[model samples]
Target chain A: MSVDVHLAFPPLARIGDPLERVSTPALILDLDAFDANVGAMAAMAKKAGVALRPHAKAHKSSAISQRQLEAGAVGICCQKLTEVYPFVRAGIRNVHISNEFVGADKVAMAIELARHITLSICVDHVQQVRDIGAAADAAGVTIAVLPEVDIGQGRCGVASEEQLAALADAIAAHPGLRFGGLQAYHGGIQHVAEWDQRRVAAARSADKAAAYVRFLEARGLPCPVVTGGGTGTVEFDAASGVFTELQPGSYIFLDGHYGSSEWLGGFRPRHGLFIASTVMSTAKPGMAVCDVGLKGVAVDSGLPRVHGAAAADLRYTAANDEHGILHLVDAQQPDRLGERLLLIPGHCDPTCNLHDQFVCVRDGVVEALWAIDARGLSQ
Target chain B: MSVDVHLAFPPLARIGDPLERVSTPALILDLDAFDANVGAMAAMAKKAGVALRPHAKAHKSSAISQRQLEAGAVGICCQKLTEVYPFVRAGIRNVHISNEFVGADKVAMAIELARHITLSICVDHVQQVRDIGAAADAAGVTIAVLPEVDIGQGRCGVASEEQLAALADAIAAHPGLRFGGLQAYHGGIQHVAEWDQRRVAAARSADKAAAYVRFLEARGLPCPVVTGGGTGTVEFDAASGVFTELQPGSYIFLDGHYGSSEWLGGFRPRHGLFIASTVMSTAKPGMAVCDVGLKGVAVDSGLPRVHGAAAADLRYTAANDEHGILHLVDAQQPDRLGERLLLIPGHCDPTCNLHDQFVCVRDGVVEALWAIDARGLSQ
Candidate 1:
């Protein structure tokens, strides 16, 4: 079913002076690393002969998506329909919403957006497909609908081949819905501590998804695409010959959690993202205060790690609303009051969501700033 | 000292349609209840015979601060100087930055801002005070400087009266800086879980702060303002006769953590904030999927608690970037797909920071939506 689009008017402007104007606790993007990260991901996908569908949820900026497309990405994957609008509003042609939408209002919004963009959305249930079909019918549009299959995360998607086939048949039966393929993403393996375990999990996940595709082929149902794979397991999935497109997002902005993972295989791409913060206070001997805290970086993946400060053996500990506590691990103190400290956030995605702009710097000079245009416009 | 005025541009136009919008991971504010909360706090301060300096770190909205000022708040206390900009830009004249700012850029920015508003900022170090004085001099502004004393939180601020007095003396010695008052905020007591212990901790904190105030009085230093207290200990500090003004931010948007805590003395203030999320999948028996996950609500105070849906014994357990896992504890089979659930975030401040708009509803109907205009404007 064609997805309806909601227009957030004034179309988000590219943040001009994101770093200079955004106050403390705002998200800052390093332009140099961000460009390199995007280029490297595209190059990796191209080398593997796989399609690159960069996930918009990582940065949620239409400008960034445009840049990705210019760099030869096939399409962009959106987490939500509401998140798809800014991209479509920016005239993005191909979009895939990698989640399910059930409500009439939400489906209607998606279908509306589909009018201007090549839209596809994932559905795990037949009821959701019927709803999407009805919405697409009302909107006078035919939409590509993919039945998501659960590999391991067990969040959405059909649990088995039988359920997946049934959902695909239901979508095929619907008038306005066209069977797109399958969304097979293993979210649980993203942070697997060991590389071998992560590869095994990815292979197992791909095997499950491949079984569904084989079933669809036997039934003669058109399954044109198979999309999935995040940054953590994208390479593994690409090499497994199961995924048609790779959606590795955080490769563009390597977070502390990703950079310091125990997975010692091929996951350590590079240090691609860093938050520039200032030492606000130094009242205690063993602790220093920073401007970034819970408001700056998400700690769900764990606390941010200190970066580029050679003198201090400091670790980011407790965080209040505005201030971050840096616990001194070694005797060397942190930069005194007024010194700028670069921080590697625990999680890149949510940390990117916290900032309105990213201050891109390279080789000790500010290059550019990217506005996380869709920073908090979650539906 | 004249402050540099930073005028905020008019708010972005209402981006999306309100009525047809599906409610999921949406911030909902009850305007009527919010006004009542402001009035209730004002009345509480009046009864205690202390001025109310409502903290802006919670709402971070000038619209809310205007109501606080109209009700009875003498001023607004911002956690940081950057937080002061939005309010100052909105023309909320009196602002006290409770957090310490010790950078060349930040101090200069503070002094620049002091040029247009009645600005006061906290200082934790003698060197910080000196820097502030120098910045004020450069900006040609005489700024009110408050010495911050650590009562218990051990984050930022002077640990003892001697340090506090010395910082005050340092500020007083500078021509551009005026020793305005003392800032003694104990952040640890704000979420103490239990009632009696929280009260005791708060009382101890107040006692320690009062002793410092008395010491300052003995030293012949005029302490014009003794501001400190949060939603958890506003009453204790007000009754302790130490603080001339109470600064409570989260009271306006009462969160689940505060509601779960017994420390606030068993009174349900009926505050405005809530997060509305939608059920995405119910594939697993006794477990439901929601759109509001780690990205929707801040989980630091603990996971968001289910509210308004009695049928589902729902509790947010695990959250991903785009999904929330609701573990149903009581219902035999809870939460059908597409169900709307109202959630009380574990922490309201950071949760609010995650949204771009507050879908204000009254009587079960979405009435007005306001942009969290400065949601991620934090630099």
Candidate 2:
């Protein structure tokens, strides 16, 4: 069902120009706020005792990761092997793959990465340990392995102490694998509404992690690292006396969904990333049209919210493949045509995925542009 | 936060010989099914005597659009000017920007596009019309304009005939602008749960569209084209005798959400596109870990469902950035590691947004690999 037909366009546009001048449905990133955000997160992590292992999955860009490292992150955490390749190629030295890998192709890729950097990954089963051993054997290198323990979120990792120990034992038995640490993460706790509730939830999960660490120690295995924590529950994780490292992404470009939550204890969400859009239509009384559609900002967490514009009460109501519908939150005048507006996406990560270059803007002027290096790397 | 770190391979696998060679989290278009789907939609349009103006927002690939034009479509509807640019550059002829253009840059882009192709765009406001006219004047090209009418989806577009007429009159009065037609689209009706309800809803919206067409005709405006209809309501739209052209996308990749909907009474969802993913981990008793995740598939319409290999009732339960938690729908067993599975994404468009290439396969053999040429063109 090919529908390839070209529609012409106006030429190249300069930054800070009205909506008409900029390209339609562009992913715009504010450089000033972004730099400030990086500085702020790094400062916060510096004050905290735990290491800041910045999650690269949020913004899979080597440029962003390099900035994070420069700011003071211990390393970067890549979500997949394919995602890590570009970063490693770009000279990111320390990386933790926060997910499991399966095939020989992926394993080979991971080993290849480890040869250049301090690479580590998580595991939740014995078979994974065996596969790691096999890959490491082929690569002639011992790979560090952390058994992922499911404290909550119900996604992956070992569920019980017995299972965790068994998996760890399997890693110990494998000549090419090392029992590096434990991944005690509660992904669901990050989205909890209340701050205290989130803290308590994190603490409870930490209890399981502590017990698992103890079990491993009793078996004459040293659990040097017990890592886990997201942007949602990092504070609790830092003070929980359980986690050795904290992984939090999205603190840089805090999204509307996460900003709306009261989980982070009064931390004001500094809107760093924004989808710069122009009001395409305002013929309707209470509705306005924008170029940012489903292809612009992600709608998984919800549609992006309009920011610092005349239509302050404007809410993104509906989205098609390429156009977003902004409706008045309160019955006010429709948006003016060609008005430039900044939108805070519902979810930053997926929204970022819809773009290539982060149009970094500073003080209403165009600044540096960062390429999303690891974007769309599915393999 | 980047707590999910996985760098090990699972030992067990259940996929057969050939499929295992395929890449991870790949978007596969079944050529046989895709051809049938295109032919079926074309046949439906031919039978209904309505011109087809398939929306390219769903596929955004020029290759696919060429196929639609070859299938007897009158033209194609693009969602954004940037999206239209690639197709135009590729020499796509007739195009209708089903959405409005706002800024000078975008309007200029739109005007430049008009110079090469018969270009039409939608406007819901007079100011947008003026801006487009200005851009067209600069480009030295005449641009066709359509006033988008809000049929049911409370997005952009005018609500009543009076509003439509005012916008239409404004476009007529503007230099370098022509009153092309009315963009009467019912976006909400596409997901109706019941067949009778969907048909009735389509009829009601069609009536509104017919009224607008009659209103324009009475006012001596050329209303030759009235475009808007999706895969869900194409049948009713073709029979309504109101819309001169149908702009239906998503007919190629019949997703789980569309398949689950009762919007189209007797429409059988041909599984043309499938997210071919591998089972990464199966350590849990009732769950299997998959390579597909929030980064692989769109969950807006709902979670992806298992298409074939029904040994386990697989439902995507949770997702991180790169890993999906597949819950066993049936208690049969967890999927063996590295097993290849076809997942029907919740929404085809967004899921397609996550990948870079469409690996076209015919009868379990590799056919063609089409780069999503226009993917990630957010701006």
Candidate 3:
């Protein structure tokens, strides 16, 4: 089966090959920009005196996670249970599932993973704690639990102090479970566009999380860690004085959506990720069709932006399953068939999950092929 | 590396197991509904005196294609070069690449595939014809070439008779190439919503294709085939008298986007595909979160709809990377924790690409596990 996969989707390029040798519709990673982004985030976290646990949900590559760890990241945060396997298999000692999950299969996976490494998971319900805790107890392993509190995202987190306290008590009641911290991630506020508005929103989220922390403290419960923040709010979150750790994923590969936002100051991310596509057809006047589309890149946010100097001449107007319609700004400057173009995806997380491997390039030459180990590990 | 993939994403359930045994966020295929859908489309094409060539880009499964072939499909259509690998490997004799592709790598793949099977591909430019024709000649293999004419889709097809003639002549110039037919697909007209509007759009597309066929006939060119149609326009195209073959993919797995359209009906398709997700979080008052999200389903068409009776009471409001937020219509009827819900995806093609395999179920029991062999074969 593995051989079948490799044969069907062979490596687009060999190491040290020229950029033109790489196949179209392949994920391209600029190593210099990536390293700079990684180092910048690490430096910002160190200066702010907070732990940097870069989320693996963005890149989904164990090799990229290793690089993050080497640059002084404390650990990594995965949004799903199965996403942790690749990192753990690569000898990572710490992992935190930063989302809530329930079911026998999930509980079994949690218990199995806890035996090999320091495993932590988030919960917003008492039943979730019991589900994993009982399985862990039966397996004779301890697991860390973090109760997630809603900080404005309003998706999957506890809404009230009563619910939060009950979840903490539920964790304390289990011998195999320990109260790790609080997850107060507000995913909605991450793309607020305006600098002032985003800053204010991040502050409100931080205040709400601080209030939850105070409630826990007043009830004589230990709140050892307070983890939150993302790429858009990392600067304010690191200085918020409430969050003990930062979980920023997309900072390493700033996409077109993030690029739309105004960045005023510290730790500006670079565009390290791109989808290299080819102009397959120029059949219509002033319009060219590229090979990358919904299957190659995620279009949930919007259509991708043509990168480099061509951005002034070409615009990606629409996407079908396997065809991206590119309209020329100047009809005279038509895109030639087989000409390559780098596309900056509208979203980074889901876009990374669409590919099997990333063609890491340095100085316009292929450097490595990093497998997206957890590409389809949504289970 | 393949073992790593299997370990990280194990089979959700074994054959003959209860549906509850399947893991959350799994692609589910109702075998009964799927079989009915296959039979319906095949019967429709047969009654209309048109050959059926079901597109494999929707399901990406060799097993599904095999079933289509058994149901009387003349051949299968793949939208990409790499996507043809699984069907070819599964002993499929006839395969047509229904989209135009360019590049030396693509030419090489085409020549390699033509050497083993009766391969046919679409082209809109003389350069694309020369590229594949030269490669096929060197390999001493005869390949069928179809020139795609723009029938209002404005994506990847020749817009003028001169360009179409050029492509046809270019194919005839090479001993290894044969002018098989004309391709006139209007993908944009597939989802016109209203019955009359869609009918008119389909008629216009048919008329345009008929004009192209007449043009070819006037020049003494034998247009043996004229293929183009999707699930939404299949009913009209089968009786249009212009197309000799029909290519409808999503009819086997009618999604929310296609379900929203009005069908006056020659053949009504059933919803055979679903994403089985568990309500993992119910901490928020009137809302719940499921495991299937942006990574599990495609949202470019729209958000998925909750399947079955609960759909009237629960709405899938939004999708995060790993969570689908569901809002309850009646606050009293909250979704229970660990409860499974079926989700009809917004789109079928990209949604199928997100999963590795489908859990085929019949009467609430798993019947088989069919691999999505060409899931990410966008190359």
Winning model by TM-score = 3
- For residues A1-379, could you state the per-residue lDDT of candidate 3 as single tens digits? 0123223435588999988889888999999999999999999999999999999999899999999999999899998888888887787879999999888888888887787778889999999988888888789889989999999998889989999989989998899999998998999999999999999999999999999999999999868889989999999999999999999999999998999998986898999999999999998889889999999999888889999987888899999999999998777874478889999999999999999999999999999999998898898
**Top-DockQ structure, candidate number:** 3
Better of 1 and 2 by DockQ: 2
TM-score of every candidate: 0.92, 0.90, 0.97
Candidate lDDT scores, in order, read: 0.77, 0.77, 0.91
Tell me the tens digit of each residue's lDDT in model 2 across A1-379. Answer: 1334533334323555543344646666667667787887677666667788889989988898898899988898888878887787677778898887787778777777766678889887677788778778777776789999878667778788788878877887777777789877787788787888888898899998898888888888878888889888887788788888888888888788778878444344477888778776676676667777777778878778888754457877777766777777665654566767788888888878778877666766665567888888766
Candidate 1 runs further than 4 Å off: A1-28, A262-268, A330-335, B1-22, B263-268, B330-335
**TM-score of candidate 3 relative to the true fold:** 0.97
Reference contacts recovered by each candidate, as fractions? 0.42, 0.61, 0.67
Per-residue lDDT of candidate 3, residues B14-81 (tens digit): 89989887997899999998999999999999999999999999999999999999999999999999
Q: Between the candidate structures 1 and 2, which one is better when assessed by TM-score?
A: 1
Query: What is the C-alpha lDDT profile of model 1 across B240-283, one tens digit per residue?
Result: 88898899988888898888777444334675787877888876
CA error at residue B248 for candidate 1, angstroms = 0.6
Clashes of each: 25, 34, 0
Model 3: runs farther than 4 Å from truth?
Answer: A1-10, B1-10
